[model samples]
Target: MSFCKSSRQQAILDAASELIATIDLEQRLLYLNPSARQLLVLPHDLDLEKERLTVKDLHAPAVYRKLDTEIFAGLLEGKGRWEGELEFRDSNDQPIPMQMTIILHTDEEGRPLWITGIGRDLRRRRRLETQRRLAKRAFDHAIEGLIVTDGRARIQHVNPAFVEITGYTAEEVVGKTPRLLRSDHHDQAFYDAMWQSIADKDRWQGEVWNRRKNGSVYLQWLTITCVRDVQGRIENYVSIFHDLSEMQAKEEEIQHLVHHDPLTGLGNRHLLSERLQHGIRQAKGQEEKLALLIVDLGHIQLINDSLGHTNCDRLIRMQSAKLKAKVQEADTLVRIGADEFALLVEDYSSLHDISQLANELKEVLQEEIDLTEHRVTLSPSIGVAFFPQDAETPDQLLINAQAALLEAKKAGRDTFRFFDQEMSQEARERLKLEQALRSAIKGGGLSLSFQPKVLLESGHVYGAEALLRWCHPELGPLSPGVFIPLAEESGLIVDIGSWVLRQTCKSLVSWREAGLSLPRIAVNISVQQLEQEEFPDWLEELLHEYDLDISLLELEITETGLMKNELKALMSLARLKERGFRIALDDFGTGYSSLSYLRKLPLSTLKIDRSFILDMGDDPVSLSIVKTIIQLAQNLSLDLVAEGVEDSCQAQQLFDMGCPHAQGYYFYKPLIEDDFIQLLAASSS
Candidate 1:
């Protein structure tokens, strides 16, 4: 009958999922639930209706002792309840862990009657708790910043990376809004749009600028995801972000290299073209003037040859610095080539504004620059082309500016020129002439002529000046005045001048070999040739080749040529004089004629320019200049030669002025070699 009662109680307890049992004071089980049977893996053959069960039957001896000491001992003392984890053995002898909650059941007399206990299987909950701890570790230790916010968008927690990235401790940021990190780079509207996107799409990701605890701004790639509950209600917001400032800076650096010159850090050609086109469009819209200037450094290669490549590069950098410092911040400076740079100017008041800027650039280039041991100055030729006037496109503007630059160079260094239609025509003609001159120099279209210099007293030939003449196949008899400057400007003067010397020396040898007595012939040398480091040595070789007397060779360099590189000219002339070759200062009174130069130069004669001689009888000032030049030559003990004495009056005046020699059409026009030989023979007779 008692077993039946226990069976009824156990049947009622079967509804509970936990293991439930009733135990007597002796620790014998009076009733146990189906959950308890399954938890212990009891044999189906042992029926609770037939056999008795004890706690010692299920629990290990150690577990029983712990139960007796901590849980059951307290329950036996009439305590209300006792709860702890305990171990029990299953039928397979494997240990099962259970969380036990036991209550002391007693009669009205306050004596313990039985222990009512419930055991929950701890394995599943233990597995879940372990997983939770692992997830917490990952969240706290992640490298990317992590933030957890409540549904109200208030910060609840932050990862260690968040604290590190923001320089904010958890104490400072918890319960605060994300506004603490806002850099104010974005307005409320931006935030509103971002939130709206997140609300509609459940997530938003982009680059954001935020402030750190130290008030420094940084860029970061941020992603915010909305977490929802099972009912689709917002539960939390999780944000993950990483700093992107370094990567962004690297990208900007790469972009900068694409549009800037590597050497000078100025704009390159590609960027210049881009900016020019944009400038044009803007100017057209505003109805404003835009000026494009192409600046070419004249004789840059000459500087390079003289100063070496390293110093030349330093000179170029200095020029760039000057240009940048002088131009307005709005203007664009571009290094387009080795010796060529371009400028795009806007916000100008008028054409005069651009012109003034151009002049300023020229002035900047004129300043003396000291590079290491060398002191140098640059002469920049600037060409200006206007918008809607000279050209409408970038290409056309650049071409027009370059054409005008050629005109500026032709006008001489340290100048600026504006574009016009005439310059285009002139440029084309100049190119054709340059090509033809090159051909004439290479082919045998060039020859020499001898103009007699006569004694002013006897009217007899003393010596002749060798003149260069060219007869182009297409344009016959191009004069020396027209082609000589071209040769000098084109750098062909060195080669042409050398050839002239060789030819003159050969002529003298032939004359001597044929038994014809000839005076010393003078050859005009250009500034380019005079500045050659090897000129003195080259002249010695020529003198040895012909086995001619060095005293019979005279070299005439213009006063302007000597002043161009005074030291070089001084050294070269001194060397020539030491070797018995006579040197004449040509075109006297046409250049800077300092008494110091007259005293220092190794000159044998001073040749009066043709301009003074042509105007001597016509202009009183010219006559006075001639008289003064003769007196100056006399004082210096230098022989004087009056050029262009075309009339008897001019020759008589030159003779009265104490000039020793005169050369002009009045004596004889320049003659070919055969005619010159005949003249020489007659003069000898």
Candidate 2:
């Protein structure tokens, strides 16, 4: 009986050793009795002495995929135990499921010791055995649907988000292809492309319409990606999707805000440019024509000032509405800038169409807008340029339109001009001349000639009116008519004006030195100089520095300048006149102004513009207008000066008309100061 007991005990111990050696959990043996390496398939690189080894000795298990590294680390760092799920794989590539239990091994009295992990492989359990107790959690709680498929996009798994989004339950979706959910919004080519992406192991993200279980269609942002095996073969396709109708709407709203003007809801500068370029290409390809018409508000600034920005805005909005009404359905009309707008009229071959539209646009603005007790009217200035004739590019078209617009402004607003070949040549020459002018100012190539402003009764030279003359080194003496306007446009007029003022003062001092007794010299001030912010102070400084009597310096202003900026111009003239300087209104009667307004202005003289004088000998209307101007000047107690009096007939008309002073080509052409002084000597002698 004793011998039998000993043999039985040995057999029991042997069986226990075999179990310990064979059971697996992915750690070094560390002197385990047996079988751990065989079960875990521990690599040779793993040492028996190692305290820790990765579960990677096999494929990491599904449970390990869900393990939170942070939580496991926290447990191991402080509590001396970590419990988590770890997925694994065997040598044959079968997925291995695992539950890992890491516990602290301690000695007596609870002293800290080694960390020992005990693992249970659950490859046979499919993680459902644990889930029956724990229940579906993360996979079911996600907000966006998570859909999985085989390499062919056949349905494999669906989450609660997926079922909720698609209105399909897991039981209904598991085996059916994802195509069952397709809304048919996309063609077969789309799905073919998606499948090709899966086979290529790529990803695609875009909006797709999907039908619900009840056959209702809804848009969703779908992201489909392929999972590849080690050999780079497509193993699975995973798609995450969210509904996209609301998002797309918000995106479209942003795009509209970017491309359209909010106030008029017109295509803005950006959209205008884009359309113009497209139109250019179309025209070129079809051998067709397009016209760019630039419409400028002639009196927007004045309206904005008098009626306030509120009414101004309302006016512009109304104008835009009218513009939309006026343009063709296929054309694009844009309020491109404040006070500036544009229209792209395609297939235009003649000027009459553009001219008619220009007329209609202007007529639309003729309606009066009531502002409290007052009413104001506005008109437009239009500039037109035809494609292939004016320009080939959008930018060039814009410049051409601008050039024409400038001409309209010169034509006195409420007018239209077409781009002509002559305009381009003229612009180029003006640019060249402007450059030469700048150089002339710096190089002292500009000279001042003088003409006598005679007192008609005595024929005595009051003083020589300084006239601008440019002696282009190669081009000979260039007329101010050729380059003065160019100078004014380029903002070089201010410098030229300064030179004239200084030279006139120098000439007056020279006349005094020469012992020639003459009246005060008059200097022509352009509308720009009148608008100068520092005109009064500048005049004071110029006068005081010249140490000349203010009476000896006369400042002439145009009727347009005086009429347009009445109050400001009056203040400026008043300030100068207060200091004893003579103020003469140049080109009088050229502009229409209320007699009350004209009478209210402080004036020393009126220089009637040449237009009224050109036909004074034969035109009764012209003669009547001239006589009325002289009478008006007399009524205002202001002197009258008639310009462009080229003959005895006109001079006699002015004399008979009681015009007090006359200056013209007939009296003496504009001459140098020396020639003028000699003429004055002859007159005096």
Candidate 3:
């Protein structure tokens, strides 16, 4: 064929030219299409060969260097053949960054004839590549686990953190939905809501349990966001989270510190107050009655001072454990003070039911506690105040129960008291006094005294009983007989009692240190204090802590006190005996069935009632009673002590009746702590 048929040649040329124009190449570039010329910039210097340029060049620097290489130069030697683009600086001398393709043509024998180059800017593609690299780096090192999914919820991407947290690498998770990480903790409603939120192009945040690499459970605080297209269709979902294990642990610790007693792990005042408030609201709503119990652990201080603080702590823990075991989930048990615990019976059916429950509690507390190689125990004195009947307010309810608790202490240890209308005024007064007592304790307003219990045969100062004497500013010198009963009633007896025990033990110890031939000092226990389940423990603790000789101490309990809680009192006395204590039966004849009861107790001494001793000389029957008491003690081989001897005759009469030990006014009235110390020194001298 000719070079081209006339018509076909023009058509082909026109078509070729149009194709170049469509790709945005200008007319000048298409016609000249020289590699060198295409890579050049618009002329800024004097024209070379009188040539003129129409447009600026667009080529990267690397492109220019490559095109100048020998390999590329040889490729274009014969005809003009070029491929790829080259660098060209603009008039400002800053090279334009661009990419282009070079074209080569051959006439015959594959020899190149003409070369053409085309270019396109590469800034957008480079920008996109840089961003991809950055995103990959971030995903690899992120602190939070990430999961990415398409609109169908099929997972597309999972970062390394996800594999670390979940034990699933991208290969295992890429095709799975987020359900793979779910712990199945949520129900249909939860998932429904989640899906609904995602469908609406919204976000979801909540707590969720997830699985770890080892198939263990983990808690996560997660956030999920749904990405949507311009048409409002779901595009993807992204979930990110950090493990909340440490945060959850901290939160639990905070909650425990707030709600539990540090000493016993029982609920404290803060927790008590919260539970009480909640209970009140619930009671009011349900038209129910709630019973409140104010429990004062009797004689805990004596044990604390005698045994040691460590032993005391152990005892307190034991008692709390016992109390917890007896209490139901609905019941709130609070160790509000050292020796005082409060129980709120929120689900009691009635007053009678509360009483029965209280009886059950008493029985449980009476159970012997085997501790530190000894069986120690004390009973619980429960004072109950019921809803609507005893109080209309929370504070009033607590007050009423406290008042009743005081009454129980006054009556005897280990007994429960219910609120009565007549106790309202007394309760208010008692409340005020208790507040004052609390202030006094904080302010250190308590004092101690000693009462000498003389050795009847020796007629000299021997051992003394340490007594608590409160030096009140507004109220005169408060006797153990006065404020102690009050203190015990108000559950303040624990601290007061603890202070007394410590003071007595310390004083007695100092006396021994001072070279005094002092006898053991006795501390009378209150009914409220004697009932503590930890009584024996505290006694052991105090003895060890103070490093006192337990045998040098005497603990006297009244028959009525013994009867109040026979099992608990017996256990405490048994524990004390095991610890080498001198336990005496005080006010022996006063109880109705003293003679019958005496034989069964773990007592070392029997002290006849003062009434019998006071009238022994006048009433022949009184003398007979004394003689009978002596014979009974002789039969049992127990030491005999006489109390309340007013004169020499009373002492002589008891002595004549063969009583072994006697203490009363005939020996000496009670002395202050300092005076008792001085007497012990003088007597030994």
Candidate 4:
């Protein structure tokens, strides 16, 4: 509750990753940490305190007014803080984009004393947006010629390329008839046949010689289609054509050598790369999207290792045919490697469309393929990268797509992954951590921290949740958010989960033996742990090994974990509960758990997730949700505990709402074993 800044507080602020600035009650700048100064790019000679700038000076006029009206007003009304994307101006009068979070610091007497602002620079995000705009311009002015005319054949609209290609500007061609470009190269009977085809089918396409404004004849591959009104009558004539005279012979030679894969007859890597670059440029120009999919046939090497190269080649040919049949002509499929292929898909509508095609590719490969003298089946691991979204360059796009494909393969084959920047980073980090965690779990470097769950009404310690924390000697303290998922993904959670259970039970026994009056301890249970068939038996063995009472332990499982295999999870919980182990559904109200379904589970407590409780102060919808959840817990005859009760107001609100138990920084953060035991002893005293 102290608004005063100590040296330790200043140190913490200075070390923070985000820019931090503190303003006093009069709104004058009180402190600017190194990060804040760096973000503002303040000159060395300019002393922040000496210059005496106010908080309002840091922001643009309109932004300051809006923040004062909305954010400050809400803070004055007792809301804790406000956070949003805003522009902060530096001393040079240039706007710096920031993701800003500001908090109003108040004294114990509830008088506002300080306002602290933390901002993260958004230059990278802005640069990406600017790139998209530039790409869009390139797409719009691309080299394809397009012309639209009235049903009477009078030219109505033409792009800039049309003027450049045909030697006629829009001013001269706007109202001209198509007859203006007619060439004597096509006889009267040929014109009649073309018009007859258009009349019959509403479309005509072929190579035709046309004269430009300067009287030079050029060959163009022209496609013209009749556009119809809603009533189905012809409204306009649309024409798309590109000059193909000089490049025709050159394209044929290039196509034969560079484009085709001799083995599968699909496009090769060179052609795929060219198409990817062209597709990206086109996507940028049209403000559309193209997707590059890298498909690796899983277990193909194993097939080659077993059935020889001839059989493997046959399998590759079979998959190529299956995949090619599914793709449209506008899309390009290329064989990039012996077992890997790439697809350059243009005009994709959304991520959903790309995923659907990836799934179809996976499905097609999964089907049985006949090889001479052997019947074989293969599965595909697919990775998709989007143009002008994932990367700007062709190489980066392909690399990212291949990274996603590697991720899919790592996550067990026959699946597909879409390229995301953070996911790739995390996947790489996860691989490193997986190896480290295997050592950490076995090398006795892992430990536990306990946060007491207190009674909301009386502020008495009711129980504690055992949280797992890791400190790698080399990597330093790793967050549970980082390592926990790695454990789950690498199938290391089962072993780690066992270690936590045994260690927590041993800690509880030691606490009781030392004469501390501690209540039950809750440990998180992962889906992998719960799904283990011998989990209940192992729990019993750990309880016996520690010589601890089963009633002293509680198991916390997430709502999503329970829903993963409802029947199996229910059975596991039932068996554990029968052995005097309490079951608490942690992070309640975050997942799709039904009240009717809750009635069937053998759960004893429902712990509200922190996110919902965080907004209970100002968000009416959150308040209603918490209230409904509390009511539902009561109806189900289950004890309710709210997580993240960071302030007295949230605690008092939950208590008044008839929710009895809570845990968060309002009372304590998770502590080491010695500190936790001391806390319990102090609480008892």
Candidate 5:
């Protein structure tokens, strides 16, 4: 082109997208098209010849230096044209990058007339290239898998993440349908619904079960969208997904832990309530009966105290396993407490069937279990409550079952009891008694009665046993049998026992001041009292407070209490004996009576249990038991006292058996403080 010669050519040059300009050999701008003016940011109204603008004014300084040395040198050396990237500066002094072609036009004389340059602004092209690079990088590095497919559902491209998730390389999956990844867990109907939704909404997102190249199935959260053309026709499909297999597995594990006992792997109390409620509903619908049995592993606290809690847990697991093996598949066994379990029987025929099952379950636990260090037997007590009979609701059934369990334990363990209205009444009465006893202990409604312990050889009062007595204002007089157990269960025995000790010391000092002296006063102690780690120190402080000798008070502990936790009881008794206090094993022959443990105890005397003493007159077995006990005491070099000695005949038999001491109604009833003093004075006379 002759560089904007005619109006038509000038108009075409002005409208062109490329920069078109002409400069003479002296580098002065001769003519400039509108595109060149705008690219250089020069005034469009200015006449280039009049303004004296040159190529140097538009080219950056560094770019002008390159054109002066290399570009112009090449164009003048018969090269005629130079094409490369060059920089142009705008009015703001900002560099504009351009791709340019410079042409050297010559006249008829073979001399350079002018140089015409055609350039294209490269900023927009550079931006498009940068965006393409970033998009490719994101597709390769994203955590979620990405897939691109053609409108025929054939895979066209796959990201590195897709290869990692599906174990399929791009070469293997390209041009293949998504059907290769189907796990076959979903039917055609499921896929049809998914496709229908996508067709309607242009997108679908949900969980899908798919197979990996390794033949393993997994869950994935997937989102698929249809890529459409301007005419709204299907062009491509883009899918993004993430593996949800690990998350789903974690959720299931959390659910299992929430509903199961961690130790035994059995159902827990929460699961029990749910299953019980469900079982009740099913029973009502089927016109069937279901029994809820509460099985209490009796004396577990004793086992825990004797063999440590770790072994106790092992024993509990063993028991749970046994109970599980004995129940049917329809039944549910739940660990409701540390040492308690509940059995839900759903397929029982009648009460007799439930009773038989309860007995079988109890007997299963009764079998001797071999703990690592000790082989021990368990005595399990079961309480049965029927659905729609004993209780109508799960909560009430559980409560009544527990109440029946208590009755079973009270009836001497290794047995089962059916729930009855009377048992609930007794449970309420026992709760009332527990509350009343707590108040009595704090309000001084309790007292101590003394029964003289006489010497069978001399008929002289040597000591008296102090008994705990409670007289409620409204209940008149409550038996020690009824309220004492309540006190022990409610943990009130510790305070009550301490109060008795202090009052007995006061009584001893008072009797001394009244010119009457009993050699020693024996006071009953509960196992809970001896279990106190500070019991010995507390007793010493109480004795010192009264200014009484420790020898003047005898501590009587039951054999059953002593045997509960032999090791701890032994240590407690040893500390007391070392402090110059006498330790007597009361109610002997009624508990374990194992000589292996008995001989190791630091005992001062053995009191024959009243049952043996009372029955010895009529039953030869009872007499032999008492005699054997007396001989055992003699052999152990321990003194003996016969309890429940009611007549001269029983006394003579005890004395003949070489029992030197006796205490019962025959000599004196449990007397008040004043009556005891009178008896003490008479004995002294």
Candidate 6:
């Protein structure tokens, strides 16, 4: 029985995967099993009895002190067995951590006999424990909400981020499924597809609408991954999600800004194109006509000068609101340019209806708009183009509509015109002319012609009017009647007028240097030029630069131009008159002949319009109108000049009518600078 027990003990020791050793009471090594020799890096052939090694030799001094002072001291103090951690040194003096059990054997009197130790290597277990602690910390502090569910889809774990995102405590959500957070925004089919993807590919990711614990729906970007065990069976599902509600809201706001005008909240050019294309498609399907009307508010610059830009913008917004009220919900209204709005009319029956609509729009805008300081009327010119008749494409339609608009403005503002082939040709010519004119202005291709203004009674020259003349390299001389309106419409009149003023000043300086005396050089100014608040100061500075007196320059303004913005025009002219500059009201009796406002004007001269002068010989009404104008100018104490004295009969009629001055072919049609200088020399001689 004893032999069997010993054999059993030996077999157990040999089969152990740990270090097994026994030592005597003197601390000398007695026996070591195969496992103990391998663990201590000792040779299997070593004879422990021949070369006795003590337990202290296998341990560092500090370790042995610890074992003796703490572990062994406890065991010797009537503790039959002890189990704890300990360290031993290998052959290379490297420490090996061990989880150890020590047993003490004694006789009946309880005296110590020998010690037996069994230890297991703890390096791998310690490394695994450290990795687990780090992973848990990362899971707890991650920014994205994390969730872990068992194979049955029951919630098993949730991170703090998950709790915060869902507005739920871990205690309340530990065993609930993800369905608890469903917003019901998606039908069963959506969830079915999601699960199908997960079951097939072991992962799924997409946007999802979910409800928080507070019962509010929120959008999130969710990614779910399946976790498998060693046997390749589903163990858990790990999900990561980030809230996207705020981000989606920002994206929508950006889209709105991209498609809308900031000042008027109307659809911009981009939205116009989109809606126009869609409208065209619908119109084509239904075989109906659609009208694209481009409404241009004329005299915006005049209004802008009257009201400051802030008030001007307010007026624009108000006008846009009124325009919006006139369009159907199916139709689109867009602000495509400053002072320009476009309306897309759908489901129109006939051209007459489109015309009526355009007329209605014009009338709507013509109604005076109230500003902070002024009530002003808007002269709206509308251009209409029909789908399939004018153009088939969006770009072509827009181009055609704009061409028609230019024609409407040309015919006169406060009107509307339909697209036609002739208008298209005219638009192209106008564009070419505008480009060439800009080049001419830059390259010194423009020059001035002087039309001598003579005294009707003496036949002596008083002064000359400086007329702007442009001779294009290819198109030759262009009529002022044609290009002048073009320049005014294109807003190039301001720059051109400035150039003309400077050129006239230079001419006057040259004539003065040559000892040729002229009373003043008359320069015609447009309404656009007069609308400038800085014109008075700028003109004064130009004169000072040339060392010329302000009286040597006569600024001629048409009655029509003056009435456009009476307040601004009066202010500008009053400033000039104060500086001793000559202010002549040209084309008298032609426009807004309100003697009330006319008397209020500060004027030095009034020129009778050529139309009445040309007809005075044949038409009694024309002759009477001219006589009345002469009397009006004389009564107003304003000097008189008769324009377009073509024959001696007209000149004799003007002289007989007591008209003081006359200018026309009868004196000299328009002379060049050198020729006009010769004329001035002759008159002086």
Among these predictions, the greatest TM-score belongs to 6
Which ten-residue region of model 4 has the weakest summed lDDT?
A: 135-144
Cα TM-score per model = 0.54, 0.50, 0.49, 0.44, 0.56, 0.63
Candidate 3 segments exceeding 4 Å error: 1-422, 439-443, 526-548, 617-621
Better of 3 and 4 by TM-score: 3
Give the per-residue lDDT digits (tens) of candidate 3, residues 1-685. 5566867855564444211110112212333322233334343243433543333333245544555464246556753444443455655576645565555556779765554545554556778989999998998899889989998888999888888888887998887788877676778798898778766657988888888767889999888888889998879988898889878899999999999988887889899888878888888998988888988777676567556677778887888887888889878999987888999988676667778877887777767776666667775687888887778788888888888887787777788888897877886877677787888887878877677777677787656666666777788687657666567556787777777777777776777677777587777775556667687789779989878777877777778866655665676677768777888888887788886777667788887888988887889998888899899899998987788888987887777778757777778787876777777777877
Give one digit per residue, the lDDT tens place, for model 1 in 105-212. Answer: 989988889988899998898889999999899898888899999999899999999999999999999999988899979989889999999999999999899999
Worst 10 residues of 6 by lDDT: 591-600
Per-model RMSD to reference: 18.3, 13.2, 14.5, 35.6, 12.2, 11.5
Better of 1 and 6 by TM-score: 6
Q: Better model by TM-score, 1 or 5?
A: 5
Query: Clashes in each model (backbone N, CA, C under 3 Å)?
Result: 0, 17, 32, 2, 0, 0
Model 5 residue 190 lDDT score:
95
The 0-to-1 C-alpha lDDT of every candidate, in the order given, reads 0.87, 0.75, 0.74, 0.85, 0.89, 0.89
RMSD of 2: 13.2
Model 5 CA deviation exceeding 4 Å by range: 1-144, 150-161, 183-193, 214-218, 226-236, 429-484, 490-560, 572-685
* C-alpha RMSD of candidate 3: 14.5
Query: Clashing residue pairs in candidate 1, if any?
Result: none
- Lowest summed lDDT window (length 10), candidate 5: 1-10
Q: Write the per-residue lDDT of candidate 2 for residues 515-576, one digit (tens) a residue.
A: 77766677888756665658778877876787867778878877765555565567667777
Clash count, candidate 4: 2
Once model 2 is optimally superposed onto the true structure by TM-score, how far is the C-alpha of residue 140 displaced, in angstroms? 34
